[model samples]
Target: MSKVVLITGGSSGIGKSVGEYLTEKGFVVYGTSRNPENYKEGKFPILELDVKNIETIKQTVKTILDSEGRLDVVVNNAGAGITGAIEEIPEAEIKANFDTNFFGPINVIKAVLPQMRKQHGGLIINITSIAGYMGLPYRGIYSASKGALELLTEAFRMELKDFNIKMTNIAPGDFATNIAAGRYHAPLLDNSPYKKPYGNTLNLMNTHVDNGSDPNMMAQAVLKVINTKNPKGHYKVGEFMQKFSIVLKRILPDRVYEKILMKHYKL
Candidate 1:
């Protein structure tokens, strides 16, 4: 039988791309959106899902298990971007970001573990960010959320090792998507301390995203990962410089790495 796959935030962007790609490859793919109506024309079945809602996650996973008998892979890909200086962002907003980007996947992972363990093998791929590796100016919270997710992914893998379940964190640098449009801007006032750099950093971030690699490439990376019996714990996807940044952080001193990031953002 073909493998069954579930991907969150699949209405558009990387989620949609990955869902379509997997469907084409003969995987029984179920892509999810907050509202299924908006994605009625999606290439794969668009299930109504809100990662922040634990109940919805459970129901959806249950539905899949009931129909498919087994679910082999789950791509936790639904999350939004937040742009602004740390202080300028509101507490509520930060919590919301974490809920969707970090806790959402955790809930899903918890919901699926039973099915995966019963099936005796499964793969969980968390969609993290390249920003998760290093803190960038004006995008601190988004980075934090991804960083937290990465940690969860690692810890979960360790606990699930003997269960024959697998997990990976895919840190994507950027891709042409609606994420830039959906990015939450920090509430700033006329005399805000971060006024100058706020605009500069937001623009630069968008520019990099505009020049980011294709979402299809990211999907292809996921495809390659799923085909493997034992996938790497972490996978980086994006441009050369962005991908290399992770390497640079490992070899360079802390201050040197800081300077490189600062210079890149003109901070």
Candidate 2:
């Protein structure tokens, strides 16, 4: 029998590309969107899900289990981007970012882990960002959210090791996606010292996103994890410069890395 896979945010970008690629490889793929109808004609069947809502996460998992009998892989790709100075960011927006990017994946994992445990096997591929390794100017919240997710993935990797389940964080540098359209932009227009810097930095950030690596490239890298018997804890997916920055963060001195990030963002 073919393996069953669940992917959040599958309507577009990396998620959509992964769904199509995996389906072509003979996996039974179920991709979720808040509104499933928007992708009814796609290669993979759509499931209506809002990762923030626990009920939807549970129900979507159940729907797939009811039909497929087994779910072997889950890709947590659903996320929202938030752009703004850390000071100007509202509490609600911060929570919203974590709710989608952090908690959303956690809820999905909780909903599926039991079944995986019973079967004695599963794979979770989290689409984290290279930003998670270090904070970027005006995108601090996004960095923090992914940072939290990465740490959680690390803990879970060990915590669930005995259960034969695997969790991997795919820290992608940038990929062409619509996250910018949905990102929460801080009101740095007036009475804020960050107005000019925010504009310049945010513009540069969006350009990287616009010109980022292809989503298919990410999906292809993720496929190897799915096929692996025991995957590593993390994988960085992107171009050389992007991947190199992540490598530098690990080896370079803290202050030095920060300076590079500042220069990169023109902060």
lDDT of 1 at 147: 93
Q: How close is candidate 1 to the true structure, as a TM-score?
A: 0.98
Relative to the true structure, how large is the alpha-carbon lDDT of every model?
0.91, 0.91
User: Per-residue alpha-carbon lDDT of model 1 for 133-208, expressed as tens digits?
Assistant: 9888889899899999998888888999999999999999889888988888886668988887787777888888
- Candidate 1 runs further than 4 Å off: none
Candidate 2 local accuracy as lDDT?
A: 0.91
Pairs of residues clashing in candidate 2: none
lDDT of 1: 0.91
State every prediction's TM-score relative to the real structure. Answer: 0.98, 0.97
Report the Cα lDDT for residue 8, model 1.
93
